[model samples]
Target: MTAPAAHAAPRIPAPPSAPADALVRLHLSESPYGPSPHALAAAHRAVDDTGTYPDPARTAPAQAVAELLGVRPDQVAVANGSDELVLLTALCLGDRQRPGVTTADTFPGYRICLENVGRGCREVPVDGIDALADAFDDAGVAYVCHPHNPTGGVLDRAAFDLLVERAAATGTPLVVDEAYLDFAPPGTPQVPDYLGTGAPVLGLRTFSKAHGLAGLRVGYAVGRADLVGRLRAVQGSMPFSVNRAAQAAAVAALADRGHLERVRRGNADARERFRADLAARGRRALPSVTNFLAVPVPDAARAERLLERDHGILVRDAGRFGLHGHLRVSVGKAADLARLLDALDIVAPVTGPGPGPALPTAATAQERP
Candidate 1:
């Protein structure tokens, strides 16, 4: 099929803002800073003790997470990653015969996992959160990405409460992928805030983002004990999923509060700089609380390809999630962001309504982290 022509992205009223290590990646929302020194050291130490199997119950990290969340250990389930949590939630957390629900232009994993588990997925539009909330009574389960992926938008507290109330009334499960929650500003509404309501809400978090453990793939779910128990039951089928190093590192990462704070400050600095760069060049990005900004662009699918092919930079095309004309760029290291700002100026010009140079084919689907 022929690719779409380059076109001008819709502009926001003029505020803007806008990598070279192995590929200058602005994709997959990976953290700019590496893991904390404490976490890294723990992982190294744990690596040396690898002759023994990791605990099948994932006790240590689950206990650590429970303490951190002020929840019981039974309410937390550690897993290989949020991706695994998504799959497990699909497998056992709701009415198996019904379809799962989520927003359009979201992380595709919910739909993928639901379909894979024989529970089809129903996607509502970006502006339709209320609609999605209302539909929950009919759904077996629903997923919401807090500080949402691809778009980075979030619900206000009132909206979040409605979803929870509806889930409580409907007896349907609500899974909130808070994979990016650690990066959200203080007071951002999240699943944890509503856990006391006894709603069937689950928050899937990861050590991948602010903790900088993407490579280690350790994540956890914290929610109602019943939902978490279902996840743990399903998780048991894949024992030893989180390795020794990942668990030890997660425990250590939680210990080093300073490292996490530094990441928060650094991410804020990088995100604003990128936004300023884009604004200076007369472009706009969606407002975001997460570590990535969805920046408007001409033909995101092609811009994504050209950015990488021509500049050795990789960014996600928001078009992949059924949203078009934008790229979801991570708030990566400063130098890398500068490189992308320079590259994007060339690949996606600020002035025209027509498309950029045509490529032969569209970019492929990017995997969720």
Candidate 2:
């Protein structure tokens, strides 16, 4: 026993190669268009003062956001990213011992975050509105991704209203993720509308997607002042409070409505065109309001591999989410979609001989490369 001395365990080795830096990063949904020119300039200005710490109060950015969203500065809590906001909100509302967070099967990373914190996520299969209504009854914290991911289907307004009402009545906090809401078709309710409904709702929006500031990692949550205060307390005094550069850029980006419109229209048109092209190739793409499409294939992995290894194009394999036979492709520039279409044509060849399967075409593929 004396001979058995304590020792450090073996360490795991790193990878052999220089590391695969650009290995088909299509796994994450990201904005293809870069950040606004104004935002970029603001970020540059921020570099000038890197020696000094960012303002702890983060009042200017908060004020700009409040003005933009018709809310008070105290009602907003900015964080490193919307992902951080999601985690903080979850921690504030649900305890590890409790049921914790609830999300649909197809969400991005809510369950992963909750589970990482030794918490549980009550998953509800995302079938339709009825399923969501049935699954969200007084849950610990219900996470709803508006204009849902992967599937890209939006909850009907009536159903959304009912869900919010139910959450309010039950005193359950509903976290509505509007990360892609900026690209939603007109008439969709803004984040404030849900908060104004007297519901315990935390509306999370991010500059990562639409504003093309993913690199800056800026996102904010709006809710009742009390809830926002709770989130801020959970956030503590982080220097990441929307740095001066990101704040300046976010303000300019918000002001530059023209750029937003261009991106929105571009995404919408590309989405329809891509779906149509997939249909022509005997595949189907799920309709989406966000800047991405989910193309269904008989073999998602094969399609993804062919795109990455063969054509040098990247796409997200759905098999990781148990959604085999599908791949999520983000919309980029017109030329980018053209390249994607050409790559898909070469990779996932349509089966059967004559004229291929007859499917309802959503749009013409004349723009397809």
TM-score of 1: 0.89
lDDT per model vs. reference: 0.83, 0.69
On the 0 to 100 scale, the lDDT of residue 217 in model 1 is 94
For candidate 2, give the lDDT of residue 172: 71
User: Candidate 1: where is the Cα deviation over 4 Å?
Assistant: 1-21, 352-369
Candidate 2 structure quality by residue, lDDT tens digits, 1-369? 011122234323545864444443455667776776666666666656777777666676777789888988998987777988888876777333555444443565778777766666777654444555555553577777776666565666676787788677767777888888888888775558877677777888888888888888888888878778888887774555657777666666776677788878877777787777767766767667787777766778888888888766778886665455678888766666677778877877666642332231211111121
**Range of the 10 consecutive residues with the lowest summed lDDT in candidate 1:** 360-369
Alpha-carbon RMSD to native, per candidate: 12.0, 11.4
Give candidate 2 misplaced runs (Cα > 4 Å).
1-27, 94-96, 237-241, 353-369
lDDT at 67, model 2:
88
TM-score of each: 0.89, 0.84
Clashes of each: 15, 0
lDDT of 1 by residue, 78-128 (tens): 999899999999999889989999987789999999999899999886555
Model 2: lDDT equals: 0.69
